[model samples]
Structure formats: structure tokens, C-alpha cells
Target: MSETLTPERVRADVAELLGCEPAEITPGENLFDRGLDSMRVMILVERWRAAGAASLEFPDLAECPELGHWTALLTGDGA
Candidate 1:
């Protein structure tokens, strides 16, 4: 949200919530496998929506659960 809805910002936001560095969040990695739960995903959905990603939804993320996919979805670069 600090910088526009970019992929990097998405990574940083997810990283912050996961309690790790942005670099640790590989784009193709499964966030759920990295400890991201539905509650946290919902938290991110609300946060990203507030930051202008109004179309983002929990099901959109839950169906994929990958950082790259989420980044793209939030940044308008993917489905």
C-alpha cells in the first residue's frame, strides 16, 4: 500500500505478515506451506482491498496460495 499495488509491495506485505524478509518469499512458493492460514489470507485481502485492490477476494487467493499468483492478482497482472 505504501507504494502502489506493485508485485514487490505484495511480497513485502505477505512477508511482513509471515514474519520474514521479503527475499524469503519466493514468487512461486506456496504461502500456505510457508505457514499462511486462511485467517491471514483474509487479513491480506482486507488490507490489499483497502490499499486499492478492491477486487481481491479470499477465494481467489485460497484457490492458488502462491506468492507469484497473489502478487499478480493484486497488481492486476494476472487472473
Candidate 2:
């Protein structure tokens, strides 16, 4: 079964990339501003795609760079 993408999951992924606590990743905060790079973003894309988010892409997450937005996009609740 496909894993569901939740805000907490998104936060956890971002936290792993940033090397910080999940709570440090606020929903509306910009990930890039918090030190996220292309490499880490691609890592997240690959991980999520493997988890069944087949439609996810670098630009989709790069353009938004926010936890809530990433969660919505991954969960198919956003355009």
C-alpha cells in the first residue's frame, strides 16, 4: 500500500535534511531559507516517489519550499 503523506511526515523529512528537530520546521517556513539545497530536495523527491508519490518533481517542491505546501502537494490536495 502507498504511504500517506502527512504534515508531520513532511516535517520529519525536512528535519532530516536540515539536521534539526522536526518542530523546527514550521509549516509556513521556507525550507530553502532554512538551508535546504538541491541535493537534499532531490533526496526528498526520491524518497517520496519511492513511497508512492509518483507525480512529485523537483520544481513542484522547489517552487513552494514550505512544509504545508509540500504536504499538500505530496498528498494530492494541492495543484
Q: In candidate 1, which residue ranges exceed 4 Å CA deviation?
A: 1-3, 77-79
| 55: Cα error in model 1, Å | 1.8
Q: Residues 22-72, candidate 2: write the lDDT tens digits.
A: 987777888899999999999999989988888888999999898878988
Model 1 lDDT per residue over 1-79, tens place: 3448888788888999999999988778889999999999899998888888787888999999998888777776642
Residue 12 accuracy (lDDT) in model 1: 86
Lowest summed lDDT across 10 adjacent residues in model 1 is found at 70-79
Q: TM-score of the candidate numbered 1?
A: 0.88
How much lDDT does each candidate structure score? 0.86, 0.84
Q: Give the TM-score of candidate 2.
A: 0.87
Clashes of 2: 0
